[model samples]
Target: MSSPRRRADLFLDPADDPREGGPSLGDERATLTEFLRYQRLTLELKCSGLDAVALARRSVEPSTMSLLGLVRHMADVERGWFRRVMAGQDAPPYYRTDTDPDGDFDGAVPDPAVVADAWEVWRAECAFADRFVAGAPSLDVTGDDRGELTSLREVLVHMIEEYARHNGHADLLRERIDGRIGQ
Candidate 1:
């Protein structure tokens, strides 16, 4: 009998080849925003149509890199850089601490409620970042922290990088989960 399809195979469209087109940007701000938006969409695409166990399944050994963990981590990262670092707030880290650095992944499980919570937090953070970026003049603006400066450009770029890195992990994890591969 045919094996179950891998989660990665289901998310990434292997039929679509990577393009070699030149970059398109009307301005730096627009370009950065677009890139960030694309990455976020890619992440969503990866997690789409997944059940609680599928989203939280650990495909690799000795690692806890589930799709749900990625969502939680991204949520924490968004709040950290935008709300805490950029806005200079005193909020605590989400789903992690010094004692449990891997809490986010460790806490990830095949629970429908947890999956819903992760998505909710991630969507809210995305909205917050979008609003902040829309009203900002430049990515190079400084926060209240002395010697600390950030631009909407830099944050967006970093977020893209972050998503790309995790997506790589997702690719393998998904592949292992079902043997689907390509995109």
Candidate 2:
């Protein structure tokens, strides 16, 4: 039997380059979409070619900043913001965190199946967010709750910022894992 594929391979699909055949950064739709796309691409680039252990490896002491953790965290963020906050839906978090707030990272392990599940969930959440945003009204759209008014533009910008912050962490983690750099 062929040896089992690495866990990180499940999350990192370098075959799908986010920058492939896309408009130049200066082109329209390059404002929010481009930044978000680049952030996602950077995350995947940071994760590529790592084994399960490497993906889940914690380089810094007392910090569980693994690529796997980032995947799980992003999944939760997507669901929280787009599904719950934006749509006003009540849903439980993607990962359990009653005992430890850092359960997302703490629970991540060097397992191929677990990695696969994380990627699947993250991709699904991304798709859901995309669909919602595509059909969503103007950025000035307001929720039923008057206090929750926010433009879709603001949410998209916030999402990009979120990815930017985590991608920075991913850069360092990936470098520590395999000396790879430069998006």
TM per prediction: 0.82, 0.81
Local error of candidate 2 at residue 159 (angstroms): 0.9
TM-score of 2: 0.81
Positional deviation of residue 3's Cα in model 1 after best superposition, in angstroms: 19
Each model's RMSD to truth, in Å?
4.9, 7.9
Residue-wise C-alpha lDDT for candidate 1, range 36-141, written one tens digit per residue:
7777776776677779999999867788889899999998888887787777778566888999898789989999999999999899988988888888777777
lDDT of each: 0.77, 0.76
lDDT over C-alpha atoms for residue 157 of model 1: 81
Question: What's the TM for model 1?
Answer: 0.82
Top candidate (lDDT): 1
The residue ranges of model 2 lying beyond 4 angstroms of the native Cα positions read 1-17, 24-30, 143-147
Candidate 1 collision pairs:
6-178, 139-151, 139-152, 140-151
> How would you encode candidate 2's per-residue C-alpha lDDT over 13-88 as one tens digit per residue?
4575665555565533346666777777777777877778888998699887799999988988888778877788
**Window of ten residues with lowest summed lDDT in model 1:** 13-22
